[model samples]
Target chain A: MESFTIVSGTAAAIPLPNIDTDVIMPKQFLKGIDRSGLGEGAFHDLRFDAGGRERPDFILNRPGWRDAAFLVVGPNFGCGSSREHAVWGLKQRGVRALLGTSFAGIFFDNCARNGLLALTLDPATADALMEVAAGPEPARLTVDLTGCSIATADGRRWSFTIDAGRREALLHGRDHIATTLTRTGAIADFEAGHRMRTPWLP
Target chain B: MPSPEPLFPHAPDRQGPRTLYDKLLDAHTVCSLDGEERLLYVDLHVMNEYTSPQAFTGLREAGRRPWRPSAQLAVVDHVNPTAPQRTEDVADESAAGQIRYLRRNCADFGIELIDLMDPRQGIEHVVVPDLGLAQPGMTILCGDSHTTTYGAFGALGYGIGTSEVEHVLATQTVVHRRLAPMRVILDGIAGDGVGAKDLIMAVIASLGADGAAGHAVEFAGAAIRALGMEGRMTVCNMAVECGARVALIAPDAITADYVRSRPRAPSGADWERATALWARFHSDEDAHFLREVRFDAAAVRPLVTWGTSPDQAVAVDGTVPDPGTEIDPTRRRAMVRALEYMGLAPGTPVRDIAIDHAFIGSCTNARIEDLRAVAGVAKGRRVAPGVRGMIVPGSGAVRRQAEAEGIDRVLIAAGFEWRQPGCSMCLAMNDDVLPDGARCASSTNRNFEGRQGRGARTHLMSPALVAASAIAGRLCDPRDLP
Candidate 1:
């Protein structure tokens, strides 16, 4: 995980809504959990045809979008399954940020946990960003987490919202477990009392 | 898409009055951070192959063992080939590797591994609780979102990501954040043909897919209390489908009875002590819900989903919705897209739609009670021509129990394939899958696009609904059948 303050990259768009995690990375590709080498499996069906050939029409396969640093997707993005392989795939594929109207809460958390930024914007603003992505040349937008704003190549800027805790976590590249460990004493105290009341629980 | 309904509509918002979730979370809290998040102590951790391999590997990299091997359980499901005859022949080499990895890793770590052929092996969600590993007033974590399934026993369980998985494996605890509690009260008695599936589907229909996001819903009232343990499990299983991470039903006699016979359950004096503690697990009378929604169980009918989202459902006899009637533009577009994907015409009776496959199994609705419902409908009937029907049990134990009760014979005689239990065709991770353009009536929880197979369509319904529809080779209401 890298401390994310401001990131600049060309954006690609997968305009389909309700893009579930299964679609992002199918169950077949989830066989291993190491998180490496999963980019090949991201969007497996949509990215590949029955013959295992790349679909020329896929946004990721299209020229100019080959190295997408960010994704401009539709609403309810990453909607199904708690599979974090979706995040691993996107991160491994070099996607640093996800710009969407909204996201499945679990998917959003998974992104933040892995040092990938997930920012929510109103559809209209996302539409503005998509326009920049679809412009004559591939567009690169500079997203500043500290400033909570996205600046397009065309000089237009749209603000976004992120909680303070998440912004700090992303900026510091903090693993959630480390933060949770700070309160181990409190956790132990509660567990000791809980064990007394229900002596049979393992 | 957050629903327009206010979450705190039940009463004026207040502070200091703890909810069921708050109480449970506070009880398990390690330390509160900024009053917004807290570290949580997880009692039970369950894992499946698809999402857990990375965490186990991470443990090996760090030279760490699971904090408490006795507290963690692993099961090989998801990609398991369900055909009892072909259990040894895994067609997909990669999926076979996944199952093998899970077995090898579980052994290396000293955790309980219920392997594919293990009679105890089944869907992790179903088998863990079935064995009484999930108990009341405990906080449970799993790599699968449907971990909320154990909330039926009054557990504070929810899904977790793989990173959280490695964290829990190393340190027995994870972080918890702000969560609001909502209660869905089922009032009045359900009419004939209406079951737990219908009740849950109706709730989703009322609250949209994201309606329960960021909240925990507690099912209560007479209708919920009246349901058997199996029915309660069915309702809680789909709680995640509505965007809820957690669902609960306070422990009662039914829950106690269900746990009593399981192999891991406490006995005699221990049981008495456990029951006494469970009785105190309810929310304080003064507790305030962030939201409260009520559904009259009597108004529910055998239900079916017609669109990609679970909320896109209606009564069995209802009609496909016209997108024009949806006031929200985004919702209207979603509806139009769903109708197009489903190849359904608006205003067409849902009962008239046809299905190519009828699948009866998933952790959601694959219990013995559900099998009995399928048997009840298929006893003297054959699957309609052109329709393929299959029933996969949730676990090998369930399959054996069904066979012992002769339930498998009734289904097999009625043209339904009877097979060992695993999550078959639910997410289509194995050999049993629908082809592109095929339409299926399923007893699974999700109906998201491409959920069953690439370009395949899924319609969510109860096991009984799936059985009746299979007999008719299309979507037909059981009430309309003999």
Candidate 2:
């Protein structure tokens, strides 16, 4: 029910495919019912070893991407399980938006519901962006959802499209429940008509 | 152009168009059901190590036990270690505790438990169908949203919160609403190189992530029929992503064949009777749905996720879009933010993005078939330098079978790690994790922030794509390999 705008932080590039939900917020974290604290378990395997030591070679250990809020990935992002925790983890970790070639269906909905931006681009454009982002002195990609375009600090830009209804919801920070609630008048009217026609029960 | 005349023109006009919640109320007959109009006869209930402990606690607190233990199934998958077969090697005490709790709860409640050591033990979603526990014409509920995976068996499957879990445990039912039905009929044979993953991706792309919100989706047509049960599961598994309460495919010969061999399935005359019942369960030819959509299977390709949402996808060979010309500021901002997080620039080539790691394992695609697909790609091929990779099977049986087929040998020979069965690295619950700033090609789900590890950049792709990326040390199409 709450709405918030996401601001991109550092741009980190991970060009891979089939990143499943388990990797996003491993199964161990799933034990808890509360949505909070999942950020800690986000990518448990890649961050540590069998002995729980951190993997120094992982991208998250690198200084440049430590605070990255934007994730550039390959195709079929969020493909495996449909765990809303995955999205909650990402949002809690401050990832405001994701750029990939494709995504898993359930993970995509989680993103939209949580107010995260998931933008799809062609593979070629994604590759070029990864190159620029991996460079020194961090390149910035501006996500203006209301404007429906992505611009980089260097003036390069990309245009994307979304369903008008979804676009409106994102702009207004409304989820499906809120969208449905907006039709209260119609629902009330329907209930009234039903009462008159059937009138057997309250 | 002109909004394409509203995709479902007749949708609103058909009986005033009910929402999923509305349909659920009608199905349950909440208004007319006797005695407070509570839920009765739960369709399905799946439990995993992660969420079952607290549910058991709630049950005990209420001085109630499982009403119909036969309907519930529990499995230990999330916390089990992917390596070190000995249970003692489970490094995380918390996970070990949960596993123990699930085992005890199952024994106490008389619910079916697929323990780690059991040959049938595996990811709950994978093992359920593998064992024929899921069937057609059932209303299934699980603690996990991926329970929708069972929808492939022609049943309604969705996730339930812990409270609902307790409700089901005590009363064998829970309050519910029905979902408006959305029928998606695929018209043609899938072209070469396209798989169930691609088919689902195409569906999401066409409908957008929220297109099926509050609907129960029914997938029909030759394309869906042609898929094996495993393939069907992959397609239905992500129904939640499309915002549908569930996704289902009617039962058929394939379903019968798959279930007949399972240990739990009926035998001889019983099997025949069960099949008869299943046959009657299919939607009648004249059955109607609230909405209908059609697609050609031949148009789909091996897909990849370029954005955070499943609907934000493209064929593997495409490039990032330029957001400057976009009309919606919200979408434009999303694209820009996605590019930034992914370290991508506008107008960049997507194929050129490199990878540092490759992973294959998860409930979604870590079945035996998935393992075989990766093995096919990894055979006689070495992982690219600087790219670390691993393969975790969904179950102990899959692990044993892969080893029997020398798939492990091929993987290890190709420099891929062959670990034991457990949810590893996929969500970083255990010791598996990506190092800081290490970009990885993973076959698990969700490429959200820190999914692989803290600040670990993840790219979601199919198993074959993960294998291909592991070999190329970059995001390359599986079709482009070999």
Candidate 3:
């Protein structure tokens, strides 16, 4: 796993609530197990017309936010399903952190496990950020995971938080399995005690 | 931090010093009776095209055929390709190979296989229940996590890893640790537009994703009983979202009726015996659960996730909670990260956001009923300009039936692509995907990042809500459409 921090180059605004997994990565891409190349197919139906051409009217096709790294979205960002591929897709596409009002429980856990930061803020702050980023030139947002803060280029900063255990794991580039392995000694000690107390079975 | 006390304080003391899960294990006898070993006596095993090829290989390598072929069923659904017909144009070689392997294995073992060309072929979850292969009071295992969808029939349905799949194929049994029971009782009637999906979303939001880990959930009470089979399936399908081992609803008349019409369901006298057995599978009137939670069905509304996690959810009308107020600093950071990724401000009205795409499909909500609901909303309405939307039927049968009923026409007239049957756009499994940075309103389960594709943002909602969003090109309540 790659451990790194990200700064939003230009804020891409998607002011939509309850964006589900199917719309983010449609079921069609699930045919493959390989994690790469999915970013290009990210929003197949939305970005392209029936003829498989890019829909110029789509927000993703717009020139201003084409290279945007920060996404300002509506409430309930990852709402449907528990597919972990959603996180892999986002991470591969250079989405280091997500800013939303709320998220689905499983989706949030998946993000934390994959070292992706999913940030929650009050609606007023989200709206302000989205408005600024939706402007012509694309506003820059900074996300410092070590600092646990997000800020705009103008120095407007907002504090964020993460689960203490998860924060430690993410900062160290360790996943749950790694954390579990750290307790091997303790587990071994417990197993030895159990064996001593009950020796009837092999 | 110390693990919280076992949610069920009295469970260990109940039933003569053994919990229900313990009893189940002992009965299976795959392990020692003293709780030192594991045992399994699975009643049903389901396989899909994506994960069964390796399992068949394992079986072949072991020089053992399926021990109980009668208990096994296979289907080709996941990689059927969303083209106009079920053809060989599948984009993934592994998916195609898996399908071919499933066909070969089923033919060799005499296990039922629903081929993609077969009208009966659909998503494993949808096909199993629709064909009545899942019955009440049985233990069912599938290679897919969404197997919990069969719990609506009162069966203990859950997913297993690939190794477990091989074990089940060769021995017709799986070693499993029983789970404590959690009861989620619904009281009162569901309000209009509130369906099983909303109920499950509300429960997950309240319990958090890991709340029911190591537990088997029993959905009960008036509102639950009132749900149709399809609705109940939707509720049970997402049980894993809360980390529950499974979710089961007691077999009832509705379940029996749904099964009665299925081709594989027991017939005549056998049916009567099966029904009697199913009726006995309910928890005893005095049976105790490890944890009990009650919800007033009327309190649930069309809910959606605002962040990346299922637990970080709110009602459509609710605003985002400020992370600073979270009691746990660690959780506060998680909330903040979710917000940044989702790009929402706390206290902002969730309904005000605009949507770029809308999708309605997946095992969680792609049943015929779900299609009908979306068709009802799409009828006579055009998709909002610049909004991309698609309706993928769950199965070939559902697709044909919808066409017969003119539901497809309604969807087509609304400018939504009426795709062929399969798990289309629900996951980035096939060619379906959202462009990078595109946000969408979807009806499938799971909103994990890029579940659709890399850099794709997903918002979970009911099918009607998805349709409404498609029509409005943003998040809008279905009730407001008319």
Candidate 4:
């Protein structure tokens, strides 16, 4: 995983609330066994029409926002499905973070583990940033995880809060599996005690 | 979505009356790490074809094997066909490749798999509980969000992502952050025509989509205790639609009886010991909760979603909602979009909404009891002209049992297709997809955009309501039949 410290780029605004994983990465894209080339499949239905032609009206397909690194999304974004493919496709398409008022439980965890910053903001503050991102001129924003704040080119800033553990892991690019493996002795000891108490467990 | 400050923060000493969620976390804890995050042992980890291929690939790339192969189980459901006749060969090459990769990886790691040809094969959530793999006082995890279904049996179960899947495969434990507890009390008996699906749908509609976010919800009270295992499973399964990470029901005689009757359950002395331990898995009378909500079950009616999200639902007798009445700007716009997508006019009766398809199957409501309910509504009734109705059982066991009870014949005679077991038309990963612009009355969990197919519209209801709607060629409540 890539460490996420600070990033600055164009921010696209998708203000539709509850844009679920099915919409982010449709079922057709999930057939792939590996994680490569998923950028084309990210938001396939929204970005392209039935004939596979790009829809000119979509924000991500418009000029100046085609390569947005941040998404200013609506409340309860990514609210369905536990498919990590949604996160992978977003990262592949060059999105490094999502700013929303709230997010679904599973999708938020997926973003944390995969190094995509899923920031939760108060509704008023999120709405303010959303306005800037959706403006006619292409909006540019900078996210500084070290300072826990998001800033625009005009020097306006909004501070965010994140779980201390998740913030530490994102800053260091930690591998959770490797970290858990080092506690093998503690796990085995716990298992021994647990099994003795409930002998019927498989 | 964070819970309100708890009365007992951490409860480190394990003193005082504790919630079922707190007890489960303490029983499974391996070690306390960072604040609120601990290494918790997973007694069972379920996997399906779609979300797990990448995890297995990651494990191989790292040259690591499963720490405890026996703790995991895999099945093929999401990307398989559900035609009348079952076959080992998948039609789509990419889907077939995924199944093949899963088979190879499970074999390499020494984990057990319920393969396509196995009679026990079904949706992971459906099959695991049917086989008695989900028991009280157990901590279960799966790569699919519906793993909350196992909490129907008093188990501590929730969903995880593929990265967590890799971690669980390499180590039989995953990090956990304790969720604030919420108890949903259901009082009074639900009248005729009201079922578990309707009750849950009503709850979701009232609470909104993210109502239970960041909370571990437990269903309790008189009406909940009266429901059988299948009803309980239906309620717990859709709790995820309301953003609950875990949904639990305390263990009782019904749970004990169901677990004991399963093939894989312990017998005789071992059973006695197991039941004794499970008796203590419920919350103490004075257990603390961050929140509590009560509902009158008698007020519930058969529910059908009018919009893309599960929360945008109303009773079967209700009319379409006008976005102009909504106060929130974002929510009002969402309602307008949903109404346009559904092709429904404001104030129109839901019964006037005609459907092209009626699907009766999913992990949510495809058990034997559910099929029996559908059969009761379909027997001696004919499906309306131009309506295509189908019933895919949850597992082979459920299909066979329904067949022996002559439920299949009744449904088939009524013009409904009796198909093989898989998650058909639920997520539409298989060939059982609805065409563009087609409307469906489905007994499934989600009503998201393009859930059944691109440009397809879905109205989610119970199995009985689905059958009643199929016969009427519209969204009709079961009580309105004949």
Candidate 5:
């Protein structure tokens, strides 16, 4: 995991609401055992066409997004399937943060473990951010987790929300697994206590 | 600056009665990080080949072993071909490689695995409960959304992502947030042809998708209590489609009877004690619910999803709804896209729409009871000409039961392909897939864009409706036939 305090970069946009995990990384790309090198397959169905050629009109396929480091998506993004390939695909493609009005519960949790910033903003701010990022000139969007706010190159700012635990982990470059490891003693004590109550449970 | 008000004013934190969800989380909390966040111990962890490989790889990369190997179990389902015998034969090369990888990983990690050749091998959702692994008052998880299926037994089980999967493998727990609770109460008995599938479909359609976001839903009322374990499973299995984190039913005599004498279930005095403990796991009278919706089960009819989302549904005999009927802009846009993709018109009667395929099987509705209902409709009849129909059992045990009663024979004589036990066509991860531009009536859970296959259009319905649709060569109601 990498520290994710702040980042300012060009933002790509996917305006489809309820854009589920199946669309993010389709079933066809889940065949391999390794999770690496899957960015090429990200958004396969929407990114490609019947002839296996890239669709020219996809938001990510445009010239302004070639260097995109962030994504502004619609509500309920990553709504289906529990595949981490969706997060892995975006992270591999260099999108460090996602700005959305809302996100699926599991997808939002997955972002925390991978050090990918997931910010939930009010609908007005989200719309404003997307409008600025989807511009012809490719406005640079700045997301500062430490400051708990997002801003565009033109100086419009909006405060967002993130829980203290997730904020602490992202700032310190730690994942939940590492945090749990640090609490090994407590976990062991809890397991021992649990076993005493239901010795029959497997 | 301070917040305007408490996020959940009536929650147990304010001395109010706690929800069933609260009890489950509190019982499993190993340690708390902050308000509403904790490392909750996982009692049972189920896995499948499609999602577990990378989790195992990550565990190996970090030089870690599962915190509790005995608490973990793995199965091969997503890519498993439903072809008969298949004892150990996986048809596709890539699928076989993944299956082999699962076997190797399970053996290395010392976790119990239901392999492809095992008689108990099936969808994780069905296998866990059939083997008595999912029980009351437990916290379960899997890397599959239908993991909500376990909630039928009064357990708390939900889907987790691969990253969370890896986290649970190494720690035997997951970092979780306290969730708001909602109760859906069904009061009256359903109509003659309506079933649990219809009831759940009606609930989702009424609320719209994303209606229960960030909440755990408790299903109650006389109608829910009257349903058998199989029917209860059908309802809980689709809870995720409503954006609910999990779905639960309070334990009762029916639940105790269902868990009485299975492989992993307790025996003798242990059974009596376990049941008594589970009996106390229900919500108290003073419990608080963020939102409550009541339904008259007698009013529900056989329903089908006409569009991509499960919430985009209508009665089986009704007409497709116009996108303009939706007030929310996002919902209107989604409906428009769904209609265009499905090649349907706003006023088109659902019964007049023809389909290319009729599939009756999935983690959502593949229990033996589902098979019996489908067989009851298809017996002594033939599938309409040019319509391909198939029945894939949920588990090997379920298939054997269906065969002992000659359900397979009835289906075969009715022109339906009697396939083996696996998650065939529920997801098009293997050989069972729809061709481009094909329309299918599926018994699976989700009906998202290209879910069945690339360029495929899916109509979600109950097994009975699928049978009737196959027999008529169109999407029709069961009551319309026979």
Candidate 6:
């Protein structure tokens, strides 16, 4: 896990609503046994044409936004699948944060667990950020988890909210699996008692 | 952060009426980590090849094995070819690699796996519940979103990402957040030709795609009670489309009967004990629901998705919506793009839209009952020329049951192809794929753009409607037939 405190980078905007996980990481890239080199597969259809060539009109294909670290997106982004591959692909493609009005529940949770910041902002603020990112020159924004704020080069800033538990986990690169394994005794005790109460359970 | 001193061996007695979800959470809580999160125990952790590989790789990298391997069930469904011939061959090297990796990982970890060659192998959502692995008063987790289907049996089941999957594999527990409760009461009986698929589609369309977000939905009332176990599963399975993580129906005689006949179900005194516990699994009379919505089941008609999203659906007799009618600029723009992608005109009637393919399969509607319903529609009717109809059962058991009832013969005799089981053409991960720009009347869930294949158009409908559309070469309502 990578720790997150603050990151400043150019942002890209895809303003269409309901950009689901299928549109992010398509099904064709899910066959690999390991997670690596998925940056190419992130938004495969939108990034490429039928001939497998890059579509120049796509936001991520443009020169200033090709390697964007932040995404200013529309509401309900990452809606459909429970695939962690979608988050992994985004992170692999140099995406450090996503600014949206709202996100799908499971995908939002997936982003938090995988060290990607999914920020929920007011609709007006999100629209403003999208406009800023869509400009001719790349828009560089700074997201600071410690400050709970996002700011632009012009000194404009907006505050956001994140749950305390998740905030602490992200501040330090916490390994949830390692953290949970320390309570093995408690888990075993619960299982033993659970068996007695409902013995028929598998 | 709080210390781990509050860990208790048994569930604490609490006052007040509790929903089924609350009871399940209380019983499974290892400890409360925070105000919103708890270390909850998992009774069964189901897995599929597509999502389990990365988790296994993480486990191997960390030198960890599943704490309770016996409590896990792995199956190979996605990315497996669904050809009629029973061969273990997968031509796609990458997909074949995933299955091989899954088999090796399951064997090495001492976990039970229904491999591709096994007669019990099928979609995880269908195979697990059919084998009685998903029982009432239990907590189940899986890598696929449709794991909500197990909630039909009164289990608290939901989907998780690969990171959570690895955590569950390592600890047999997940750091879970409590969900707000929403109850949907369906009143009145469904009219003729309206089934569970139509009922759920109507709910999704009425509530919008994100209506149930951040909530655990409980389907209740007279209409839901009147439905059979198969119908309950259908309703719960599609609950995810409305953004619900968990969907539940309280256990009753219908659930008990379905579980009693399963191969792994308890018998004798154990069965009695299980049923007694299951009977007490319903929400209390005074249980508090954060939100409630009531619908008249009789008013629901056969629905077909007119646009890219499932909520963009309308009644079969309805016409496509014009984007000009939408006041919100963003929503109107989305509607216009969806109409473009679906190749539908705003004023065109849903029944007038022609389809090139008709698919009947997916975790949502490929059960024996669904197959039987489609068989009834295709029994004596021939598929319209130029419409390719295919039926892929949810699992090997469903395929065998359909064959025993001669459903395969009827469908095949009507110019339909009876294919082997797997998630064939639903997500198009396997050899079964719709051609680019092809429109399909499908029984599967998710009408997102390119769900069946790249640039493919899907109009989500029931098995009967799909069958009817195949016979008519368009999106025809089942009631319009005969």
Of the candidates shown, which would achieve the greatest DockQ relative to the real structure? 4
Clashing pairs in 5: none
Note the DockQ of each predicted structure.
0.57, 0.08, 0.07, 0.83, 0.68, 0.80
- B-chain TM-scores per prediction: 0.95, 0.89, 0.92, 0.97, 0.96, 0.97
Candidate 1 lDDT tens digits, B1-482? 87863222222323556677776776576555654766677889999887888888877887877878878988888887888564566778888888788888988888888887677888888898779887888899998878888889988988889889988998898767767789999999998888999999999888878788888889998899989988898888898877787899888888888898789998889988878767767877888898999989998888899998888998888899899987976688889988998889999999889888999999899998999999999999999999999999888778888999999999999998988778879998877878989999999998987888878899999999999999998898776776
Best by lDDT: 4
| Better by TM-score, candidate 2 or 1 | 1
**What does DockQ come to for candidate 1?**
0.57
lDDT of 5 by residue, B206-246 (tens): 87678788889999999999999999999999988888888
lDDT of each: 0.84, 0.70, 0.72, 0.91, 0.87, 0.90
What i-RMS does each candidate reach, in Å? 2.0, 11.4, 11.1, 0.9, 1.2, 1.0
Query: Roughly what TM-score does model 4 have, to 2 decimal places?
Result: 0.98
In Å, residue A116's CA in model 1 sits off its true spot by 1.0
lDDT per residue, candidate 3, A1-202, as tens digits?
4554655567777765556655666565554534556676655666876568899976667887666666776655654544455666767777776777666544665677667777777777776777776777667888877788778888898777654555565677663333333444543443344333222111
Off by over 4 Å in 4: B1-12
Count of backbone collisions in candidate 6: 0
Assign candidate 1 its CAPRI class. medium
Off by over 4 Å in 5: B1-16
| Docking verdict class for candidate 6 | medium
Q: Candidate 1, residues A97-181: lDDT per residue as tens digits? A: 9998878777877888899999889878998887778756788899999899999877889898887888989999986765665
- Distance (Å) between predicted and true CA of B150, model 1? 0.9
Clash number for each model: 5, 133, 105, 0, 0, 0
Residues A110-144 of candidate 5: C-alpha lDDT, one tens digit per residue = 88878889888889988888788777777888889
The digit string of per-residue lDDT tens for model 6 on B1-482 reads 97743223334655678898888788789888877899999999999999999899999999998999988999999999988886989999999999999999999999999999999988889999779887888899999888899889899999999999999999999998989999999999999999999999999999888889889999998889998988999999999888898999999888888888788887889988788777778899999999999999999988889988888999999999999999988889899999999988899988899988999999999999999999889888999999999999999999999999999999999999888889889889888888789999999998888889999999999999999999999999866877
